[model samples]
Target: QRGECCSIDHSAKLAIPIMVAKSDGAINQLCQPGKKRRRAITRGQDEESQKASSSRRVTHSSVRSDGGEESFKWILSKRQFTDDATKQVIDGRHCIWSRRRQRIGEFDEFWTKSGKSWEDLTTVKDPETVISNFIAQQISVHATNANSNACRTAVGMLFRIQGFHEERINGFALKQIMKKTSCNYKEEEKGRTNLQVRNPSEAHTGKS
Candidate 1:
């Protein structure tokens, strides 16, 4: 061991730097370039996604299936109306109406197909014209004349609560649809009555 030059192990120096780096928390920074910038980028993506989710303005809709009424809540945006008085029309507005008579989705389609909704029925400047279109659309779906009339009545009630009067007891288009349906019903009834009278034997035997 005299000429062995003290046998100093060079490998031990490599292990010392690694240990120091770990203690100082610089190993991560050294092995990964731009570690701080990468973390900042990740934060940026998360913030961007958060902002997008926050800015999404979709309206929420929920309806019960139990053939019972459900509460409707709409938070009035302060800036949506020009004055507090107008805003009062929407703040805490609640309505409990029959929702099981007809599918609200079909009714919603009736509005969406006509460029409106139950919520926006009174918001439009020309509800008469819009409703005329809506009624016609309903009839086009082959909805029974009575059902079409009922929908118009429902919208009129919604309007009244929003401080609007019925444009007319029955709008022009609605009156026409009702009249046409009424005439058809009368004719059908008359035919059935005549048939029943012609076959009294069949009626007595319950075979008609």
Candidate 2:
């Protein structure tokens, strides 16, 4: 036993400072190298931090999913202002009217391809529910995220000026979608700026 190595008690806390003194030979004998000790402490800290971060991420994701579903439902519940009296309200505004016509053509074409008529929207003044969903879906999926907010805003204005109920176009539910679009636009622009900074030539050439 006199020549044997001392047994290490791995479970002991090592946070206390080692004191070199006449009374502390046992502490000095059990001490590990500073780098290894620091690394073990850091590893434990990192694991704990990662677990907390993962929990936060899950909660955030759940909240986001629920909010998105509610917003989508609200947008889907909206009805288009297709009354005969209100139909021509935006006709004098050439650009808005043209956009509306374009949207209608696109919506009808989409349904026609699926063996459905645009007139199938006759239920519940439902001209809006499908069209609103279609516009949001198209813009969100097809339009560049950088222009997401602008595209939604432009189409949303068409609903507003055409004399739709405020909640039909500018309600809190619709605003949620717009808020998401604006956030995406900002994120996209930020990423683009970062990419350009990292590789100006590649960005200019549109290579990545």
lDDT of 1 by residue, 134-173 (tens): 6667777677766666666645543444444565434676
- TM, every model: 0.43, 0.42
Q: Write the per-residue lDDT of candidate 2 for residues 1-208, one digit (tens) a residue.
A: 5334232332232323333353377656566566678999999999999999999987765554443333222333444534443435434455654334443444444445667642343332433454456557767566665344443454454345434665655556556666676687788889889889999999888878
In order, what lDDT does every prediction score?
0.53, 0.53
Residue 1, candidate 1: Cα error in Å is: 99
lDDT of 2: 0.53
Clashing pairs in 1: none
TM-score of 2: 0.42
- The runs of at least 3 residues in candidate 1 whose Cα sits more than 4 Å from the true structure, single-residue gaps closed, are 1-96, 99-105, 115-120, 200-208
For residue 96, model 2's alpha carbon misses the true position, in angstroms, by 4.2
